[model samples]
Target: MDECSATKSTSLETLVIQNISNVKELKSKLSEIIKKGKDYEFDVSSCVKTLIKSNDQEIVFLTVEAISELVKCDEKRRTYSQKEIISPILDILQKEITTENAALIKQCFRALGNLCCDCDSSRKIILECGGVPNIINLMKKYFSAHSQLSMYAFKTLLNFAIGGQEFTNAMVDGGVVEMLQMVVIQELEKEEIDEEAVCALLSLLSLINENDTEILYSDEINAGVLKVLTNTADIDVSELCLDILHAQAEHDSVKTLIAKHGGIQVVCSRIEQLMQKFDHGELDADQSDVEAILKQACDLIVIVLTGDEAMHILYNKGLGEVYISMVKWLEHTNYHLITTGVLAIGNFARQDDYCAQMMDDKIYDKLLDLFDVYVSFGVQMQKEHSVLHPIEPGTITKIQHAILSALRNLTVPVANKRIIAAQGRAAPTLLGALLSVEDHHVAYKLLAAIRMLVDGQESVARLLGRHKSALRCVARWGHAGEYAGAAGEAPRLLAWAVKLLTRGPYWHNIVEVDGCISSLVNMLVASHSLMQNEAILALTLLAIETLKNISPSSEHPEFDYEKSFISQLIKSEIGKHVSILVDTNCAKMPVEVAENLLAFLDITSKKNKLALDYKEAKVTESLKKFAESRQDLSEDLKNCITGVIAAISDNGKD
Candidate 1:
């Protein structure tokens, strides 16, 4: 025998007679045996025999407990052969299935569920031994008087159904649906029944495929489920029903049933009721409860508005009017309600006609006004106490995201661009919020909005250019914030800004490429990894553009900035020091390090113009490569490189 079996045998008598006084001691011994790495079948079989023969109920319970642990071990270790030893224990449980010792039978069924979950053979054995019928009988006998036992049986049945399609089909054939329906109906009639039963039914229905849902619907099993979802007083039951409906919303038949049973309307009503409670301050009774309700409401609205057919139904049913009214009401509340209302309105605005109607009604102005209000609030707080309002971050983030989303739907690019430009330095307020908010989802939304605004005309682009100080602010907050700046999200926003300034028509008219380049190069020189990546990305864009626009001996007076910027970039460690690569912060910097460094280098290089031999070699090498490559070199670039070469050669001659 293996060490596991030896340990099992040594403890068999103690488990069988219930003579062990210390529960912790027994658990410790069993745990040690399990860790011994040995076959425990013989010991399990011996314990099974002793448990069957013993008349002590506690001993029987102890033996079942030991067997359950061994079964779990076997499953984890893939010791399938050892499970056969528990077959006799099933017979003992079968003997205890009568009304008198129903509690004992319930424990045995719990053990069987655990065992079946592990061993396919054990599951089949359970089925062959009439486990389903026994559990069903128990479900009926104790479902009313003994709620705990009924819950046990319900849980066991759920486990059985989980064995696979065969078990699921067997369960359906064995009147499990009828049993569940009866319990659901019974629970509805009573003032109280086990919440566990409701949870079990929901779990069971969730596992069923669409075909099963169809079968259940055809058999009228859905009525009870729908009734509970639509009419129940219990919020938990209603929430579970909504979950079931949402999961099955994709099925045509289920969608029809939901529509027929008023699922959407009921959900909408509940949301409106919650909104009303929120407006009246009644929802402030419990923060957790309010949050849960809000989350459920959002999920339901998203589901209902997801598909075209459902959305059409919602619009035709006047959900749009109700939703717009809600948004109007939410224009002055706390940030949470405002955020939720904004999301709901954004979803509704996805339809072009509906969005046009909203625009016609001046919803965009109201939202922009909310943004102004938040900015004013932030500024006021900063002036009064020399510190910004604590809630200003979240408020700004939500309002910005909402306005951007609404603007995207409005599709009036010129008007939207003007609105974004009007925000001026306040645009950095949203960036500040992105850096400070604990929730990444909010930050992601805010970044998306910033991306849209920055991608517009020259006015908006220039506004961003003036706020170069804001970039370092984001970097600092990201470094000190709890979530490590969410690398994937923040970089996309930064990259989007860089891409826009490089490619957008607004690039030349509004942004000083040199100043932007300096800021980006400084960020690249920082210690943050995300900041460095974005900085390099911006630099790469600049390089690509520089290559495209510069040519040999062809400089225009207006190209002075480009020539001077590229010369400075190439001369400093900003290009050569690989260690300067840090993460992207998408915010302000601590100092104008990149800009100041470039200025310093330009002044010194001109003063020491005749003392730079290596500079000539470097410029000459770059020019030779650019010429030989046969690539389309621009006039400005060629002149820049040639001028650098001439300057260096002149310095070398002195």
Candidate 2:
């Protein structure tokens, strides 16, 4: 045979050896043979088949190693297709997974799992292998033993269900749901069972989607899972249970099961406990524990209230009051607890009545005060933690995000636009915090709040315009290439600011107009894609407004000065900046900018003064091309350009 054939044959023999002392040599040989391409599939398959037949557990374990290597090779080189080995390997794995050798059986499942990473073929293989039965058996027999093989088996089964609905149906049909119910009952019987078992069961349950709610609820699985989620003191297991319940809560039947299983009271009790802890300063104790509980509680509450039925139930049960009370505690001294409380309250305040009531209670003012505290703390913390500057360290950007979100929620337009107006430029502090913080979620939250503020009141627009330097600070650095973590949100915030300036009632004056235009022009020239898009849209809107505001009869003739402004706009550095705005994928330039330009050119044409003292070739060429290109020019555009041509001809006639 050729050298390649000889290498494959040698590697196949090495794969079958029950007592190979040199794992390194076996790995190297397999790597080389698989790298040889499709020809080596038969050799690798034959070796794996032989290893599966061997009774020795060590040899069975060796099959896992070989399969892992093959998978790695397929991933890196794509020289060998997994299709060649999948059927033969699964066939061998099934034959080896008998009850007599459970450990070896578990290892075989793991090997099959390594092959199943292909995702496409895994579901078919899993159903054919009775993967659910094997996984349930392993969960029952070996879950508490800290066996890595057992964990691998359970995890592999999880991958199958997570793949899609068909795989989930397979598990449900195979009684995996009943098995999980038994595990939950067993865990509940003991004051303490292995958290890993509970975690594994929760992971398995999380894979079930809305379609499987009937099967899970009919089997009584939902109630048992909720019991563990609400009652268990073990935070890890409790959190996992919450995750599963959250998924199930989307369905009406499953949500009813959660309520029947005492979920509402349990969740409320947990929130109350957290509040008490915060009130008594116990939140600082075992901070890791506090963080785990708070995060889990927040996630569960958010999920439970997400649906209309669930939210209606929560409101009837006075959960809104509890949320408001928690918002009050958010004003306390512990930054961590305050941050968590703020996040939770922000979500609760999304309800219109809840927000209105919170506003009536002056929650809006209190929430703003909380933001000030957070910023102060962040500054102090920064100083305390900084090695060079010795600056005051505060609650970081994440805390700032929570605080701003709460403020935004409490101070919404329907709730109270006046509070936001009073804050004036101080409101942009949230944007400033966003700039300083590295977290993307925090940055996005702040940007969303800014959008809301700009949407409500025009004074916020004037305030931002007055603070041009601050606006530039965020606009400039937010688009900087090196700054990672949600840099995109900054541009969105700038876009909102631009929208306010152009469309806002108060920012319609000429001075304010120029500032808004300049800010947009700067952002248009920036390198950030998100910022450029937002800037373009904003510039387009401003251009439209600028045209709409212009009239021949205005008391302030600046409104009638469209010709001079248009001339200056096209001639200035900002005019070239328009090219970047036009070329962007965002297509943000105002339709009015084009309309006004056409109007000015048409007037010049009609007045026979189109050639009046033009200096910039680019600008002159741009105008000339617009005149020459006759496609789809609006009536207003045609009339305006005709006016310009007539004016130029009249000048020539004179």
Candidate 3:
């Protein structure tokens, strides 16, 4: 920075150039220049270029060391890359690699690594120079014999891999995947493992997989390696290994293989061990590192236990302690950790045995408590400008989705359903979640959980239906934009609520709820055929209730069935939506829906005014076109269409 310091730096480089013929002095000056941490001065690059071509291996090695240190800066890396020095260094590497010049070869590896640490262009040059195969060869050659060289080679390849897909593909083409797999298998098969080497190799393999899933999907990881590495005492190796397993878990067969090789026991074991350490504050690694390892382990548990076989192995053989440990995530502030714990419990709740076991453990009550905490915390944050802890909204949405989905899965067992409904907290908690949902995915999960809980449990359905705000919430979700998840799932929930409530003593209360009819009418043309049929069934059920209300047994004469309910259905343009469905989606429309639609039209169009409106709108024409377009119409559907047309014409007669 000063003139004297600049002159001193220049004099040092001049001394290197003056003593260029002396290897010992050159090494000393280069080491001194490296320590100075100077950028790429023209004098430095030019002198290093000349010294790199020396046949003396030590000169080449020291020149490379100088290049490595100089390229530590972004501008220097770019400058040296443009100086055309990488090709010469690579040339020397190719020449020395054949001769067992271990020090020079290792230094060349280090230099190449530093050169391409974050430089994509330099990585391209190295790959173009066939650096990958040479590095893979060195890795293969020295993997079993020279651990240090192998590590440098692995780090260099990892640097190349940081360039992403192109460099990763090169490594794969040059047998890098196979080379790393071999390293893992070989090292794991030995009596004593090199934790660092295996961890590095697994890290490389995990990176490659992350960059190219096609390669990872095709890679057949050794079962023995999976078994040993998963159970390895080394946290780093086990963590990296689980990351690969998590990526490969996308393929069900890979999940099966992992389970068959005892992946569940080992993964859960690691989870339990780390959780115990965390609980006792006896973490052996950095807190963040411990959390990362624990997160990866929990991720594997969430994925690998998705299959029935894995679940069977887990609950049947008693991996219950791991589930207990996962439940402890509730006490942590990390949203991801809490979400993963909830997801794993969801996977475990797939079967009756575990659901019952979890119910007995009061896991359901604890999750409900956690949900209440989020709700109360949210309120507190709104009330107070600052709080002791603040959670991101996105993370809060994720936690909500996970908790709702887990509750949904847990209610799948028939016995658990009754107990959950009997517990009295599920309905209100679920309704609160549904009301608080701002994300479509979370709305979908909450609706699905409510739907699952209300499937055959009439008491729960009526419980959810009793809340008018809950009914309105379901209706809003039914039309929640084009997010097919909530939109498609909401109708089923609404239909169940309506069907159950219409049969209960509160039929009058539900029918008066605003937006309920329009929501069902909108669902009549839902892209999901089942949703359309559900709307039809639910509407028909509501129309049947309206007919009952209009009959002699009608108790609530003060409420106008025609103006309040039927007029709302007509105003919602139910017949128009039905016409569109018949005209556009005829061939794809289910026969049951057609029959049910005709039955619903017949029921709702009982009044002469409604029939006249249907006739004027040519709803009959659309129905005939629908009948003509659908050649696969069932006999029941045909009869229903005829009966509906006749009933409409008769009602329309002046």
Candidate 4:
């Protein structure tokens, strides 16, 4: 009896029907549900179904508003979308937006906008149901008449666009790009700008451009727009504007215009403000956001700096705090910020005077110090199974490339070269990078920078020769393989090392590296005549140094020819490459190459069995041809060739 006679309570669904059937009662009941949202066990989709059937404006508005409130919860939004609320809600909007039902229309838009915020399916429904042109039209109509309604429209369109390329394209086809430009221009002209409206529109435009890079907004941009974009106090709005401007600046004309409108100064001013906030620890945004703002600012600077007008502006403005900020970013813990800082400063260093100024400020030293950090980090990463603080190896490698690229440009001036080489950090840091960074591009940059650093500076080469691993890396990189430019540059730098160090103890360091001998020999046939000449001379010096080091006497008379440096030199097939160069390009070959080639062959042949190896390589034939064919051959070169032939032929007869 107790089981059959349970306590009576009103079923909420029945109570909902009784209360919500009448229009006035339904409004009040919906308001209560909206107010005490989670307290009610309301069926939102059922209400949506009932409201879609009703023609009464108030009932539809109240129900959709209630649905909007309920769907704000993520789970309910997905449920509502799956229940097919989009087509019905869009139906209500399509019919009522035609009327002057501003209140109902705005409420409907708010509901659709909430649904589309992050719900991809609902967004697809809205797009498929032809909701874009409707929303954009309402946006254009209500932009000035009703600001709130226009904002709702903006939010809805942005949501739809966020669905990705298809939805973004739909909005663009509906002429939303021009409409967004109008909104931005209008906001800029306002006595007090509406930062929210401007931010939303700019964000939508950014999406449009992202989806379709061919769409350019540069023509609509003006001085007022540039001023507002660069001077905004709102961080989000500033970020949006920076993104839009970065896209537009892809066109060179826009870059010139922005720079002419005092773009660099204004942008740098914002960067300086952010930097000030950083220094005081009074951040208006999170740390990453602030750094992102700084990064965007620097990126814009990088692209714009490609223009003459921008460079001129930078030259005049002097980048007071901007320069200081970028230099600070070089030392930041964030590698992205470091890369951006590198790009900006690299662009700045395009001017010789700026390079000198940076050098004076010791900015180059800071870059060198950054390289030193990576060098140590790379070593640690290799030795430890797990690091206490792990960073991606690829990230640091990219930064190395960036830093090397900047250094290459910075060291272009001869005076800067001398100063950088004299600083004593450039040589080791750059050479050490060759071992730490295995990327071919980084190797190329490192080699070029070293080439410039050691162009006229023998001291720098000698300093680099001290890092044995660096020499070994250079030797390996100098081989004829992929990335031939890097290969060529590597030998050029090694040639510098060999030429200058052969007289000193450092020659042993160069000769002992695994591929050093072969790298030098490969250059003898290199297409660059000057490199060939340098190679010949460097090899001759190397041979002289090897013989001097292994010269036999009573004390150390037993020289193991198989284990000697000359043995390794012969194994490189230098005779074969030398024969090819002389036979084909003998007339074009320099007298110095001929002289040094003969000297090198004569020195190597003096060692046991090496002369036989040369004869086996047919070096005797090329040397005899050189002695007979070329009228430009000097008496000294002739004598050298004769001496080498006699040495090899005599050994062959033995």
Q: Pick the candidate with the highest lDDT.
A: 3
Candidate 2 residue-wise lDDT at 140: 60
Candidate 3 vs. true structure, TM-score = 0.82
lDDT (Cα, tens digit) per residue for candidate 4, span 151-237: 888888887788889899888788897777677677767788877777777788788878877666646654545766765788888
Question: What lDDT is obtained when candidate 4 is compared to the true structure?
Answer: 0.74
Ten consecutive residues with minimal summed lDDT in candidate 3? 216-225
Q: What ranking of all candidate models by TM-score puts the best one first?
A: 3, 4, 2, 1
Query: By TM-score, how accurate is candidate 2?
Result: 0.55
lDDT of 3 by residue, 545-574 (tens): 777645422566567765677677768876
Estimate candidate 2's alpha-carbon lDDT, on a 0 to 1 scale: 0.56
Q: Cα lDDT for residue 350, model 3?
A: 79
User: Candidate 2, which segments miss by more than 4 Å at Cα?
Assistant: 1-175, 178-200, 206-220, 246-265, 271-290, 303-309, 316-322, 332-336, 381-395, 419-451, 454-462, 468-471, 474-518, 522-654
Task: Write down the TM-score for model 1.
Answer: 0.52
**How many clashes (backbone N, Cα, C below 3 Å) per candidate?**
29, 49, 0, 0
lDDT of 1: 0.54
